[model samples]
Target: MASFPTETHRFQSFDGVELAWTEMGPGNEGARPVVLIHGYFSTAEVNWIKYGHAAKLATKGLRVIMPDLRGHGQSAKPHDPASYPRDVLMQDGLALIAHLGLADYDLGGYSLGARTIVRMLANGAAPRRVVLAGMGLDGLTHTQGRGRYFHRVLTNLGSFERGTPEWLTEAFLKTTKGDPEALLRILDTFVDTPRDAIAAIAQPTLVVSGVEDFDNGQAHEVADLIPNGTYREIPGNHMSAVTRPELGDAIADFLAA
Candidate 1:
């Protein structure tokens, strides 16, 4: 539960849309840089900073870069359909790396953020190391399944019953103060990444997920897809896993190794 100092900055993405990103850990030039993207419907604060993951990574002498993905946090949330083209999140991530002039760095993300990492890799964004947390082969290959589920959740926000998966997602969305219209557009931005592209990823990758998190399919199967991928399981389900210190520990260990 330790709190770490963080700095927030904004930059224009590929489409001139202003996006916000936060930085934590050592500021010195020698500190290794790692870009950590948050999950869908969650901001950098809720996903990384709020749960002490950023702090944990920072303590290990890493410069953690966490971006509040478009339509999620402090970034621009345009409801216009045109604002969210296919694979927009991946483009924004690539743009962020270019804007920062990161020639060599690491990348990590959870859930939707993990999906974004896969998209970035497929689209030729090369980071030295990568961590795809809370994702699986099915999640990457069957993007429409999860997208359709989220689309339903957003379109019928108040109709879900208590304790249901949709209700939990909606509750989390409410807590994040997410814009439904904008998020619906984000859902439209998703496109399936072929298994061959995933198989071609050459970076050392870690496929870590919660033991109970089957929401995105089997994590080990994702590890099997990548050319140089490893699988690790942490405590908690999809919703609770990110909050656990083991998640940060696993990521830091992998990155440090």
Candidate 2:
């Protein structure tokens, strides 16, 4: 029945951009923490906290470090497209780990956050474990259609009629209070870890997907990329699955293993 209080902190990223982090769990100095990266247009609150992901991890005596990726939450939202360098999100996570002086940890993310984790591994990170949710093998290549859809929504925000995909997505983005222009740039600069690189990450991994969400391609294929990886399916689609206790539980169980 124990619960940890939320503590927020800001650390300067390598690029000098200050990013925000929400830390939870007993602040045990020796505990190897878990870093939860959120999807695009998502904050620490949405992707981790509100959905009870952090809480579940906290109850297991695991520290949860949830950072609001720059341009998404309370982090700096530079409106200029050119300001977001390629691999900036991955850089933020790596910078945070270094700033905390963590020698070992588990890392995971959903959607865009998962893609960043892949890049982190491709860049030589060797986390104790990784949870890749709402992403698939197709993540290793261009998500052109996905990017184009978000682009169209951002550029033609008001043009879509109610109940349409663009309209609904715009509404969701507004709910997160993310800057459309900043998010557009995020999409602009997003890229995948090369196929060869993804296949080479040998760390233990869990690839979780919703029963109805296969938009990113084959989940099994993504799992196959990791020599020690496995895949699991939960109840909902990309967005709805975030709130399911199953999602959090699955991640917790994997990291604990």
How many collisions per candidate? 0, 0
For candidate 2, the C-alpha RMSD (Å) to the true structure equals 1.3
Off by over 4 Å in 1: 1-3
Clashing pairs in 1: none
Off by over 4 Å in 2: none
Q: Say which candidate scores most in TM-score.
A: 1
Position 191, candidate 1: lDDT: 83
210, model 2: CA deviation in Å? Answer: 0.4
Clashing pairs in 2: none
Q: lDDT score of model 1?
A: 0.93
Residue-wise C-alpha lDDT for candidate 1, range 83-131, written one tens digit per residue: 8999999999999999999988999999999999999999989999999
Q: After superposition, how far is residue 227 of candidate 1 from its true place, in Å?
A: 1.9
- Across 102-182, the per-residue lDDT of candidate 2 in tens digits comes to 778898899888988888887777788899999977765766757887888889878889987678788889899979888
Per-model TM values vs. the true structure: 0.97, 0.96
